[model samples]
Target: MARFNHNKHHSSTTKLVFLISCAGLLGAALIADFLWASSSSAAPAYLSIASSWALEKSGILVVQNVTHNIAHHKREDVKDRKERIPERFLPATFADLPAPELQWEEMPSAPVPRLDGAAIQIKNLLYVFAGYGTLDYVHSHVDIYNFTSNTWGGRFDMPKEMGHSHLGVVTDGRYIYVVSGQYGPQCRGPTARTFVLDTETKKWRSMLPLPAPRYAPATQLWRGRLHVMGGSKENRHTPGLEHWSIAVKDGKALEKQWRTETPIPRGGPHRACVVVNDQLFVIGGQEGDFMAKPGSPIFKCSRRLEVVYADVYMLDDEKKWKVLPPMPKPNSHIECAWVIVNNSIIITGGTTEKHPVNKRMILVGEVFKFHLDSLTWSVIGKLPFRVKTTLAGFWDGWLYFTSGQRDRGPDNPQPRKVIGDMWRTKLRL
Candidate 1:
């Protein structure tokens, strides 16, 4: 019963140790396979829970950590390979390409052929007001165009006393404000009478008259105030430097008297006035204007030697006029030819400096963009033909211009033809 064999006992112990080692290796192999499979796809919920618990209890988390490290290294290797590839082999992306060419489409023409008319767009309707029509007649009727239907809806008569040309028109969505302008044709003396029209009711109400009459004045609404700036005087030849404003709400003036503000640096008429980011900007105008014959009974106006300027001035929150970068070229007759697109003000057709050789009026056909952020100017594109006094409107990413004096052709320098034809182009920017 007490017989002790050293060799036999040693052999039994060795066999037990070998079996234990084999079992440990087998368990490790199973864990490695499970880890690999789990990494590729989701494991069963119960299996995941059991494995987590077993790892914690058996202190085998180091194995899982090692497996995770190997997978991380493999991912790093793939990323490194991608990074080493040359960029020239990659396919070109849309952002790397140039913008597509813009195409223009012809739309229905306006009922009346006019120039220097004020166009204000309200929703789908474009209201074209008093302009110089055929035979030098000032149109007193308002033409309503439904852009959705691409047709002229109808016409309505303006107030009998309302001025016909050089009228500074601005709309506050519901009401259309018509400021000082020549009451009749042939550069007649301007009228101080100011009128506001209720677009919904198609009725006109008289507002406080301007302190002084102005022809083609730069007028715009800013911060609940109606601002009326430089324009031609009663003689129609002198540029008024006076800047005036009156507190206005809805279509009526709140103050009894017009308040005088800082005068514009350079006074002129037919300038493009716009309010952007609470700032008022005046761009591209002429210093001189057409003058009336001294002894004429009807006071017929005659074209005077005028100088067009590219100067740009801005009135900021400080209420001080700051000189901005001038336009790329001298421009005028842009009273109603400008539209705001994003951060830039795009001006369509307008008058530029006269030709140096022939001294004939030069019309601008290229669309000009004034970036508000950068305070820079750029030539974006050109109109089908050169034009001046163009009434411009923007809606649904489309830029529309109608009723302007158009040039004969691309080679022609004179813009003698007044067109009622409407044209529109999709604006990418």
Candidate 2:
């Protein structure tokens, strides 16, 4: 029943071949359309290709392999593009920045040479209070420095009754509180007078006096109260253990009588007192003090009897004094030579113990950092020269100090060069 029809067979074969060609062209057109759609829209390349293949009923394995190859090539292209970009044009982070260099700059000198003075910074103005000037005379005027102008603004008279040296000074931004100190030159007896100065009005007002006068008391303001503790008593050689507080608000004493608190474990003067996070810290002082000749006129004093100590103490929330790690060495005459930076306290320029071999007074020149969190101390840097009674301040990441007594030489027993030269250094952390 096989009939030989060559023409019919050829026609059927040609039709079959034509159908195969059309199917191949249709698959190619589908791929082209999907690629164009992916380029012009947000649809993913692999997703577009998969949709096109699903409609064509292509092999699942073939679709996956081709899509994976395309994805791989796209990843490579992105990597190449990133490599073409410059590093500086990219976004930066704090870690990428360089550390600040430690460089010191000398600024305009203060109006008058001062030692044992008190300085407080309010906004852009620095107010320097009474201190020992040239020829052992007391400076009764307040010197001001305008940081914006880099020049001494002028001088204003301090209260005539205000003590000239060994004053306990503190500030609450707008007001400066001056506590008990030696009323005049040499080793004069301490005064019980307390004064407050309104920096805005440039006026001084007397407050309720201290129960007992003190020399270089460790004074600070904390928890709406003015605290005074640890200083030389009426007998300049005796260290007082008395601790007192007065309720104060808006620069005025809210209470009449000074209330007694727990006395400091180590009672002495010339200590750095600071209030941080509601905690009070007392650092560095001496047991004995410079005393005047029994009946000498001008009350000439001798420093030979003093015994410097590196003791540190802190008053806690429970109002109990807790002993802290002492300084690297004995330091004194640094009542105002400390500044808080971040979680650390930076101290510079103070009087240390006398030289062991020569028995000469040694001045501290190293800048010290005390980390409150770690309870550790580190020598961060050195000062241009050894000094004491330096008034330290911090502003805009810079540490500054103005007036102090500079060391004459390593062998000199006493610091005879009092300076008003100001110096500042940039700080990082």
**What is candidate 1's lDDT per residue for 296-353, written digit by digit as tens?**
7766767688889889999977889998898877889998999999999999878877
Per-model TM-score versus the true fold: 0.75, 0.74
Best by lDDT: 1
Best by TM-score: 1
Candidate 2 has which clashing residue pairs, if any?
none
Model 2 TM-score relative to the real fold: 0.74
Q: Which ranges in model 2 have alpha carbons more than 4 Å from their true place?
A: 1-102, 410-414
- Show the lowest summed lDDT stretch of 10 residues, model 2: 87-96
Q: In model 2, how many backbone clashes occur?
A: 0
